[model samples]
Target: MNIKFSPVPVEDRERGRNGNCYNPGSPLTEGMKKQFMEEIKPICIEMERKYGVPAAFLGGQAVNESGFGLTRTGYFANNFCGLKFVGAWGRKPPQIMNGQDFGVETYQLIGQPDEAWDGSVRIIENLGEDRLIFDESSRYDNRYFKFKSKPEFFDFLCRITYLNGSEGRLYPKDLRYIFDEYRQNIQRGMSIRESCSLVACQLGKSGYCHTEEGNGTPPQRRCNYYSRVITEAMDEWNTYEWTKIALTQN
Candidate 1:
């Protein structure tokens, strides 16, 4: 399913211009990467276990939303994926992005865990399978449409690449390539343990960091150290399960 298109280094910026949002560059920052390990990694593990979705999807989605764990809202909301509301199993998803007077686009911030976690499993199930068909009149493209089934979705994206005067394609092949890219990035990352340790160290220095609420803040001097420990624990927990999944090939 490997597909290639002209590299649009400016595509993300274009999405921003069109009021459609996309991740910019690497999603996580150094400090926030630490925080992600300390705080958010566990949920990703659970997502793998319960949803039967690949850890990579969760990881990528988080990377997409949190801007690689940089933005403050992304840090607090624990939303790494900018999952918009889909009602009736993909019938009509309301416009979730708002535009400013100058036409700058803004996305709605989700706060609750349920806001993201509940429906994401379904989205993940369709990941790299669903295709985006553009409609010139639809808001998201005015005529942009998501196909109901994977095969149809895939073909639709392929068909439209040369249709409607567009130069790019978004078919299954493209999806596969993107997934491969994401996996490669994950594979190149530090081992879960090391990443968590880095995060935990930062948390310990902060002294006020806790994955779940109610864990009181520690002193500033030791906060970074404690954070590292917490992150390591979380990493261990996630990695253990992720390992099981890998071994079983489930």
Candidate 2:
């Protein structure tokens, strides 16, 4: 879901013309943190074990992206990271998908042998077979990934983040670059806080908080707000006793 629709002026986007809210100010509450951590921490740890990504950072991202299952897509689509459907699934695309603004094209996933698909985004991989489908709107368009369970969603995120080659860097704005940085940080055995900070700062430079054609803060500032929020979320998620328990096992 790498679509950046700047149809209107960047001013309009910041002023809420498109109805996209970038900041919510409020951090996760204790009860909210506790409940959410209970739901996602285990999955985050699982993804960490499988991918070497920090559970805390990944969980923080889920909290930031999905708003703890509060957003429409979060609750309905179960799409935590805005993973869009860029191709079809199994067979040719259905005609209904083309009725919208424009025709929906099916494509073969990168690194997969079968190739071009319609319906939902699917690729043969070790993460898991299930993929999430997002057919409601085209904002983060592309069949988007769907999952049967929440853990699967988290796992998909980790796997996709770590995908090699050209297509693997689709999500998270700058995954290829980010993964490289994280890989370095992981090899160094940086603490969760340090790793997440590295992620935030690097992504900020990638226009995480940019506006206008190029009229926005520097990379440091652009990504600062979300980076701060994400890092804070990790702490909030950590305070939960259950989250502590799960992380201990990790």
Candidate 3:
């Protein structure tokens, strides 16, 4: 099915909103989300068409976490969903190469993200001012992977969600989105909401946010809210696109 991700592309999700997730007057506005949606439209469509997980669900995840590309962390770090850096995150002990401080950490884009070495991954560094230089010899600590482009970053998120399996007895059981489990729903042809619920439930159990209820006090911990908010945003985005199609078709 040739699904065109064309939506009139509403006002950037980041701009002029009553109640948004992060701080008010955030720079990354809804307008940014509109662009991001188009930018990643191909990737999202490929994901949904190839696999059966609704593209809206994935869109929601990105919109929910990174505010559709208006987040400093996700923007500068290329970490669209706030995937923390862990386990050999940076150079083993940093290095000093010919009077220059350096460190080389395995690229986390592909392969098992662990001590295990993957020959294909390329190690690079963020050399300030939107400059990413190849420094396999650098030992200086590096945070999350700063993707070269929005599409690359989005692709990383998709692969992770569709790959990883059950983590051993370390942290929470369902602390991350297990794509294998989601694949079942994909095979069964689940609705977008169902897919959202399934992934949202797992995300709740994981790091989406604390699920425990409180007096809406400090932090106001609530599980699955992240997924809910993102999914809703994604659904609305789809509506705009669908609405455009409806009007044109008529």
Give each model's whole-structure lDDT: 0.34, 0.51, 0.45
Tens digits of lDDT, candidate 2, 1-250: 1223222112242332222322222344667646866788677766655665666677777787767754434555566665545422222344324323333322211122111233343322222222222223322223445556687667666665444324344344435667567757756877657766677666666754333334446665667666787778777766233333444665
* Per-residue accuracy of model 1 over 1-250 as CA lDDT, tens digit each: 2212221212322222221223233333566456655454445444434433334334433443345544333333222333222221123323421233223233332111122222331221111212222221222211123223223322322233212114333221222333233334346864544433433344234332333222354455355545444444444335444434542553
Using lDDT as the yardstick, the better of models 1 and 3 is: 3
Q: Of 1 and 3, which scores higher on TM-score?
A: 3
Poorest stretch of ten by lDDT in candidate 2:
107-116
- Please, what are the lDDT tens digits per residue for candidate 3 over residues 20-134? 2222124444666678777766666655554444455666676667666655445555556655333221323323122122232222221111222334223353333323233
The runs of at least 3 residues in candidate 2 whose Cα sits more than 4 Å from the true structure, single-residue gaps closed, are 1-33, 86-144, 165-169, 172-177, 186-189, 207-218, 239-250
Candidate with best TM-score: 2
Compute the lDDT of residue 60 as modeled in candidate 1: 36
- Using lDDT as the measure, which candidate wins? 2
How would you order the candidates by TM-score, starting with the best?
Answer: 2, 3, 1
169 in model 2: Cα distance from truth in Å?
A: 5.3
Please give the lDDT score at residue 53 for candidate 1.
Answer: 30
